[model samples]
Target: MSSTKRLLASIHDVSPRFEAQVDQLAGVLENHLGKGRFAMLVVPDHWGAAPLREAKAFQSRLRNWSDSGIEMFVHGWFHRDTGQHSGAANFKARHMTAGEGEFLGLEEATALRLMREGKALIEDIIGREVAGFIAPAWLYGKGSLAALGQAGFALAEDHWKVWKPGNDEVLAKGPVITWASRSAMRTASSLAFASLARTVLPHALDTVRIAVHPGDVSKPSLLSSIDATLGRFARSHRPARYAELS
Candidate 1:
C-alpha cells in the first residue's frame, strides 16, 4: 500500500426511517468522492422502529451498495440508550451523547447478543461481511468493549481511534471529525471544529475520518459545511475504505 494520507467518510444512522436523509448525504458524498467510496453505518432498527429486516427495498439497496464495493457496518441494534448508568458510564451517557450511545451501558452478555444479531442481520441483507462495528455516538463501556472482542468483529472505533478488537492493534489514531445537528449549540460547535479540522487535519494526521448523520440534512448550513469540508479534503487526501486500515 502507498504511504499517502487518506480520508475516510461515512453516513450514519442508516435505516428506513431516515432513508431520504441518508440518500441526501450519500449523494453529497458521491458528488465529492464518487459512488461506493464511503461507508454506511447502518442501524438495524432505529429507536426500536424501522427495522432493516422488514424493509425489503432497503435490503435490496444495501445489497446493491455492498456489491458496488461500499462497505456496510453494524452501527447498533436499536441506536438508543435505554439502560441506567453510574460513574463514568453515567457521565458519558448524560454528556457525550443525547441518549444515543447504545453500547455505553450494556452488560457483556447483552452487548454480545446485540453484536452477533446485528452483524448477522447486516451480513444477511448485504450478502457480505460487514466492515466492522461502531457504537452509536462512539461511546463504549467495559462490557461493550469486552463483548466486542468476544463477538469477533475485526474492527471497532471510538472517537479518538480505530483498533482491531481481537488484538487491540491501533490501526488509526486521530479524533473523528463529525457534525451534530440536534441543537443549535452543537451545530455551531461542530461546524467550527470541522472548519478548523479541514485546515489542520491534513497536515497533522495520515488518516482522517469524517462522519455525517441523517439529522444533518435538516440543516442546510450543516450540509453546505459538509460539502465544503469534504471537497477541501478530497483534494488533499485520497478517499479510503475503512477495511484498508485492517
Candidate 2:
C-alpha cells in the first residue's frame, strides 16, 4: 500500500424514486467531503418504475451535479434481478442480495444492450461521459463481465475491487465499506463491519471505498454510523475522485 491514502465515496441507486433520500445522503456526504467531492451511481430506471428520461426535474439536478464535477456512473438498468440463475450465479442471486443484482444472470447480448442503453441515457442527460458502470449490489455474472468490456466502459467495481473494463486491469483493491438497511440482520452486520472498518481500513489500504444508498437515510443509526465512518476516514485519507484510480 502507498503511504498516502485516498478515500472514494459514492451514493448508489440514484433515481427519482429515491429522490428525497438521495438528497439527504448527498447532504451527509457533502457535510463531510464538500459538494461534488463524491460520485453517484445512477440507475436509469429503478425497478421499472422511476425512469430518468421522464423525470425532467431530476434530470436538471443531475445536469447540475455533473456540471459541478460530481462524477456519475451508470448503475444497473432496472436494479431488479429478474433472470433465472444457475450455479454460482444462483447462489449469489439468493444469498448475496435480495433480488437486486440486476446483471447477475443476464446473457452477454442482453447485458450489452442494457449497458449501452444506460450509458447513452445517462451521458445524454448529463451531457458528458459517465465514469463507469457498476452493477447493482456489486454483483455481475459471467455474461455481464463479458458485456462490460464490449460496452466500452472505462471502469467498473465489484464488492472487492475497482477495475478498468477496457483492459481488465485492476485499479484499486479493497472492500467497499457500505451499510445495508433493508433488514435488521443486514443492518446490524453492516453497522458492525463499518465500525470495524473505521478502525482498520485507514491503516490497511492505500485507497478506501465507502458507498451509501438511499435507504440508508431512513435509518438514523445508519446515518450516524455513516457520519462517524466518513469522519474517521477523512482524518486519514484525502477525499478522492474515482477517476484518480484510473
List the global CA lDDT of all models: 0.92, 0.93
- With candidate 2 superimposed using the best TM-score fit, by how many Å does residue 113's alpha carbon deviate from the native? 0.6
Runs in model 1 deviating more than 4 A are: 1-3
lDDT of 2 by residue, 1-246 (tens): 233689899999999999899889889899988889999999999999999999999999999999988999999999999889888888999888899999998999999999999999999999999999999999998899999999988999999999999899999998999998889999999999999999888889989999999889889999999999999988888888999988
TM-scores of the models, in the order given? 0.98, 0.98
RMSD of each: 1.3, 1.4
Candidate 1: residue 95 lDDT (0-100): 83
lDDT, model 2: 0.93
User: Tens-digit lDDT track for model 1 on 81-191?
Assistant: 999998988999988899999999899999999999999999988878999999999999899999999998889989999999999999999999888888899999999
**Clashes per candidate, residues 3 or more apart or on different chains:** 0, 0
